[model samples]
Target: MRTVPGRLRPRSLRTRLVLIATVLATAAVLVCQATGLTLMRSWLVGQVDDRLTDFRPPEPVYRDIADGTAPAHRPPPHETLPSDFRVYFYDADGRLLPASLGSGRGEPHLAEDITARDPADGRPATVPARDGGGSWRVVADSGPDGMRAVVALPLDSVEEATSKLLWFSLAIGAFAAGGVMLLGGAAVRLGLRPLTRVEHTARSITSGRLEQNVAGTSPDTEVGRLGIAFNTMLDQLRAALHRKDRTERRLRRFMADAGHELRTPLTSLQGFAELLLDDPDMSPARRREAHELIAQNADRMSRLVDSLFLLAKLGDAPTTEHGPVDLLSLAADGIAASAARHPDRRIALAPLGAGYGADPAELDVVEASGDPHQLAQVLANLLDNACTHTPPGTRLQVRVGSLRAGPRTGGTDRPGRTSTGPPLPAGTPAQVIEVADDGPGLTPEEAQQVFDRFYRVPPAPDALRDSGSGLGLAIASTIAEAHGGRLELDTAPGAGCTFRLLLPASGGT
Candidate 1:
């Protein structure tokens, strides 16, 4: 596209606009001037013709010529005419009677052929002078005794007047064209001033000044509307750039944390292998313990990798098997399995609205559409998080039921309470599966980061052995989102934590 040089292209809009306006104005002026000149010339010629048609010679001059006794040398002394007018006489035989009438100054000599030809009718006609001086407007009419009288008027005055007018109009047109060009150029520059400002703002933004914005955003005129749209586009661009920058920072941090998590288990496996290689005479029991430790580390690394892969998959496009799954049944199964795993944890199914003080017999089954396996994993992760973080024998209740639209169910805002979840619309038919514990809950700051990958609360001094890989809640949150739901946490520092998995209820209320 750049191969062609831009010299022929107008670089400035102001120049182009002014040039076009000036050209059109000049063209219109020229046309009007030409039309005026044509009309003026025609009117002047018509005035001369009218004068010639009204002219008539004295009666005695005509009677003398008819009697063949008129003098061929000059007109009678008593007869007088305009200095530019002339009269000639011709007989029935079409021969010129040489005597003519005139003021004797500036009279045009008529051609011989014009005098010889019969004057067929009385109408004005132009004929060239015999002496080649100029042209004449002449009219011929019949007179007494078959004599014809021809009257002639010189056209020099009319030509002179029209010529002067033509020159004057040209000068005026030239002046007007120049004025239009100058004033039009100034007007165009003023009109485009706002666009110039917009260009400057864009340049500043391109040079890393993301906060720069265009001014004069009124939507009244074309230029004003352009500025409004330009400012809007700039705002959107700035927001998109900010989001991209934030995503990059998060990605970098995630990579660093993932590497650190993988390195620990890898380092352990290497240490154990090194120990085995250095001591070939190790006892069977010692060797068995080393192998078990290696196996445990491998298993831990495998679970972390799988969680990372699952999170990545969910981030892309998550597909779930569409079917009706009972949240209450899933909750029961999750409770039983969790109880078996941590027999001392005292986990149980809570009654419907149990935390809100509703009767247990009023409980209703909560059903949603999603993959059961993924839902089960979400439940297991929530129970495991509660069990691992709290003291043994902590009273954990898993509640599964539908929440009617409008106010939040079973919870109210309190000091230091925070919710980290996608908002559930107030009009949606929502079913919630909540895993609440009566143990020490998290602070607002911890709650905000709980759903982030590889985030974990500082474990208790005696609970290091039970601390997890920190991806359980993150994976659960992802699964919840994949199933068109959200995992919400309402917790305060010592007020206990409630993790609610809210999904759209499959069957309407």
Candidate 2:
């Protein structure tokens, strides 16, 4: 098993998927924004340049230049020009010259001022800059005399209009991008509609639903592959469940058969015993012989049938109530009873290490929560097994106590312990009852299979006859599980064996 680390948690599926999509979308937005901004700026600059290039002087200004009656150095003037562009003229030098409006080619704003300037054109000329942040287009030319002409326009208006258009484009682009994302998400979700149905179907059949499957026709699509995988998993689970069900049924049938086979002899013994008791003239020797045979067979049948019945019940009929059951007392009673059956054999209980066996403190009475009938059944099987296998004088020990699980089981105690306790609650308390014997025990491998129904391990070649119907340990194991507990074994060949039953403790929710 792999351990899970919480401090360094693994990333979630949803977070990973959402992050991938967000990153891709963000990259697309950056690419689009860059492309649009570059193109808009270039286009606006071209339009401004073309508007300035198209400005030209009127016909009167040319006429004046051809007639040679205008100022000697002044170029033909414009009658009108657009607000975006400007033109200026100079006498072969880069100078700020005067504008001659309407007496020449292009139109200008101040006509009277241009006419008032002297014929001599020797001073630097300037256009009053608009908004103090404007650019002027200057065009210079010589006129009819020693005169000059110029044009000036503010750049503020052209730039302001361009800025407004760019801002509007930005707002529209942002809104469109957001809308596209929403629409894209909706389209993706809509296109995968079949997946939702597939998910619901998968959830419905976690176990034993062999007939349920996704009947997907579009195997080429991604969603179709998912459906195929889901159906495949269901098939495997259904097969496993079927196998388990068959195995359980077979076990139950074995127990039922053994119970009937043993009951016949038991009924005969009881009937004969009653008849001998009622006889008025029978000799004492004859009566005692019949009585002993009847008693021996009766005891054997009782133990065998009881074990079979317990196994049968465990397979199909478990009572729900987990009430009080003194498991310790049950084991002691079984030991005393088994000893009485074999008077020739000496079966004894080992003191629980306190030496003072008569004192309450010296005794360990494990008061666990479970069905008394079931616990007694378990105790009898284990105790009987100890007596049958070991030497006549070997000691039998039963211990009942609470078990504390480690971190893996949440340290909570389960009330019953045979081998596996209830999954250790994180903080739950659990109980365990152990039946140990000094008799020659089973090997590890044999012990493991002993709890399986009808699994009879052959005894040593020189050993005595087998006494059990091969269902005793199996029944004991079943009773343990009925209380949400497990039965575990500790022993090897020639070594003593201990069977432990672990369960949930009292006050466990």
Candidate with maximal lDDT: 1
TM-score of each: 0.76, 0.44
Kindly list the per-residue Cα lDDT of model 2 for residues 123-224, writing each as its tens digit: 322234433444433333345444455534444545676577667666665765566567655665676667876866867665544578887636788888
Q: How close to the true structure is residue 89 of candidate 1, measured as C-alpha lDDT?
A: 78
Model 2 spans > 4 angstroms off: 1-236, 239-307, 344-365, 406-428, 459-466
Alpha-carbon error at 67 in model 1, in Å? Answer: 6.6
| lDDT of prediction 2 | 0.60
TM-score of 1: 0.76
Find the candidate with the highest TM-score and give its number. Answer: 1
What are the Cα lDDT values of the candidates? 0.80, 0.60
Model 1 off-target regions past 4 Å?
1-9, 42-161, 320-355, 359-376, 398-431, 460-465, 479-485, 502-509
Tens digits of per-residue lDDT for model 1, 1-509: 67576568645778778878888888888888889989998898899888887778777888776765756646676776766778887776666777777644455555444343445546888877666466788888777766777898888887788789888888877888899899998888898989988999989988988898889877888888998898899889989989899999989999999999999999999999999999999999999999999999999999899988988887886755778898888998999998898877777687658888877676567788888988999999999898888876568888878775444562323354344455666666778889998877887778888888789897644442567888899888888878777777878777889998888776676
Task: Find the 10 residues in a row with the least total lDDT in model 2.
Answer: 409-418
